[model samples]
Target: MIGLVLAAGAGRRLRPYTDTLPKALVPVNGDLSVLDLTLKNFSEIGLTEVAVVVGYRKEAVYARKDELEATYGLKLTLIDNDKAEEWNNAYSLWCARDVLKRGVILANGDTVHPVSVEKTLLAARGDDRRIILALDTVKQLADEEMKVITADGQGVRQITKLMDPAGATGEYIGVTLIEPEAAEELADALKATFERDPDLYYEDGYQELVNRGFQIDVAPIGDVSWVEIDNHDDLAKGREIACLY
Candidate 1:
């Protein structure tokens, strides 16, 4: 299976850095970027072929494409998302629909996490042809997180940004294993989500699957370090955890 990374959004809160580069290109360490770490993590899992959905500052990614590929020893496929600056990530992910058929272990370009997170999901994915999300069950709940509601505290009942933090079992940590069997249906759900509203998070696509009686389960990362880079504050935290990775 090929790996995927959605590096499209214009993280406006991160100004000067994002002015010339997409959030994925932002440096967490001295020279290594969030994309660098993401590709590194994928490489550790032996994923030599990967696709990246790029927008916002698409030129920036194109500029670094060769370098990133060389660094991770990966064969990179770039998918363009034209609505990146105007719409949300549901569309960004949908832009990659045609390319993802072998299944994929996807991660958001803006998140900083170790290879262990990928390892966790990969291990749990064993022979199960379902979407498996890497969830942060150990982290405390917050309103800003993309919370997940589970029926058995294991099977995802709902996944949304609007869910009440008190009722959420855990946070969907922006990384997932989408098995091949569910790819077509997921593509359909993502299209429906973006068509209904141009601003829905990609989590809504997973919700659509669950609504259609598909199981979206969670795998706990188990006390691992991870941070989603949204603003400067998150960038700082990302830098801290990046070093540990």
Candidate 2:
């Protein structure tokens, strides 16, 4: 499976840094960017081919494409998301539909996590599992987190940020493994989600899949040190935890 990264969003909360570069290029650990860590993890997992969805200052990624490839020792396919500034990540992810056909270990570019999270997801891959999300069961859930609710024997029942935090089983850690078998349906779901409302997140697309009777499973990352950088505060937290990775 190839590695896919959704790096199209313009993190407006993070100025200056995101003014020229996308959120993915924001450095969490010294000169090593969030995208750098993601590529490194993908390379470590022996995924030599990777695809990245770029928009909102795409030129910055273009400038670093060759260098990133050389550093990771892997070739990259940059997918364009023209609507990134206007729409949410549901569209950004749908833009990579063709790449999804090959199956992918997907990561949000703004998340800073250790390679173990990816290793955990890879280890949990089963024949019956089509979509497996890295869920942080150990973390305290908040309204800001993309929370999940599961059924007894079934997989995920609901995944959304609108749900009450008290009722959620865990928070989705912005990492997922989408099997080739589920890609087409997921792409369609994403399309429907974004077309219905451009502000919808890709997590909403996952909700659409679950609504359509898809068994979306979850794997716990077990007390991992990770952070999703959204603003300056999150970036500070990311930098603190990234060093441990």
Candidate 3:
């Protein structure tokens, strides 16, 4: 399986930091960037071949490509997104559909999590061919979190930010394991999601899969510490967590 990262968004709330660099390049630990931690996590877990979907000041990432590859000991596949500034991540992910059909572990560029989160998703990849999402079941989520609700069989019934926190089982940590068996369908779903609305999140693609009678399961990461860096406050919290990793 290949490791994929969605690092296309402009992250406008981040301002001057994102003015030249994408959100993924925002340094969290000294000189180590959010991309650094993500690549490190993927490399440590043996997904050494990675594809990064880049846009919104993507030149910053390209400038550091060789250094990043040498540091992580992974082959880099960079996917360009021309509409990154206009569209949401649903399109960014769909842009990578042609890159990895065998399988992929996709994570958001702005999220900072430990190797444990990747291990949690990898551990659950048994004979099951369904898509598996790493969910933080223990986190007290706010409205901004992409929440999921499970069915009786632990299948994800609903996944969206629109749901009430009280109705959610957990927050999807923006890490997903897509098996070869489901990659094509996922791509189609992602395409449809973006075609319907350019601003839709990739979780909407998961919702499309669920709506199609496909079972998208959730692997709950118990008591795992992670943060999604959106603004200055989130960046501060991410720095603290990055130090622990």
Candidate 4:
């Protein structure tokens, strides 16, 4: 299986720090950037062939691509998303269609987790299906976090940014294992959405798939230490969790 890391976002929320560097390159624990940890996790999971989607500060992200390959002794593929400024992650994924066709483990660049990603990859079953990692209810979740609502104790009913506290069933941890057929369907849905509404975000693509009655298996990751680094506070919290591993 291939590993696809979506790191093309401009990270406007990250502000001044991202103004100088890609959010994926932001230092998390001393020398280790979020990208570093993500690549390391993929390596541990035996996904030696990896592809990174880059946009903002593409040069810096490209510069480290070779370094990661040399350090991990793995092949690294780089795909540029020049329209990152105007599009969302759905567009990024759309740009990596070839890689996705090989069946990919999709991960967000800013997310950090302690779970065994390889185990999760191996746990995936069924054709034309998706396995989404759903985080348990935490003490608090930011408004920007994506929430997943599941039904029948098996499938995802909807995925959306937290708009109401009472509506959220769990947070989406940004780790997903998808079959090639499902990836193609999602890509088609994303393309249609963007064609109709150019400003649509990536979460809208997920909602489109759910609305079409696709079966997305909800994998509950309860108590699994994971954090998404979007700002300085998240960086500190992610480091704290990383220190425990």
lDDT of 3 at 107: 90
Give me the overall lDDT of model 4. Answer: 0.76
lDDT per residue for candidate 4 within 1-245, as digits (tens), equals 78888888877778887897788888777777778887877787787798999998888888787788988767999999988888777788788878878887888888877646445545655644564554555636657778877777457787888467467777877877777777688888888777767777666777888788777776656567778887778878988877765
Q: Each candidate's lDDT (Cα)?
A: 0.90, 0.94, 0.91, 0.76
- Better TM-score candidate (3, 4): 3
Clashing pairs in 3: none
Model 2 alpha-carbon miss at residue 88, Å: 0.4
C-alpha lDDT (0 to 100) for residue 96 of candidate 3: 95
**Residue pairs with clashing backbones, model 4:** none
- Colliding pairs, model 1: none
lDDT of candidate 3 vs native? Answer: 0.91
lDDT (Cα, tens digit) per residue for candidate 1, span 86-117: 99999999898876578899999999999999
Candidate 4 off by > 4 Å = 137-142
RMSD of 2: 0.7
For residues 22-42, could you state the per-residue lDDT of candidate 2 as single tens digits?
999988889988999999999
Q: Give me candidate 3's TM-score against the actual structure.
A: 0.98
Worst 10 residues of 4 by lDDT: 127-136
What TM-score, over all chains together, does every model reach? 0.97, 0.99, 0.98, 0.90
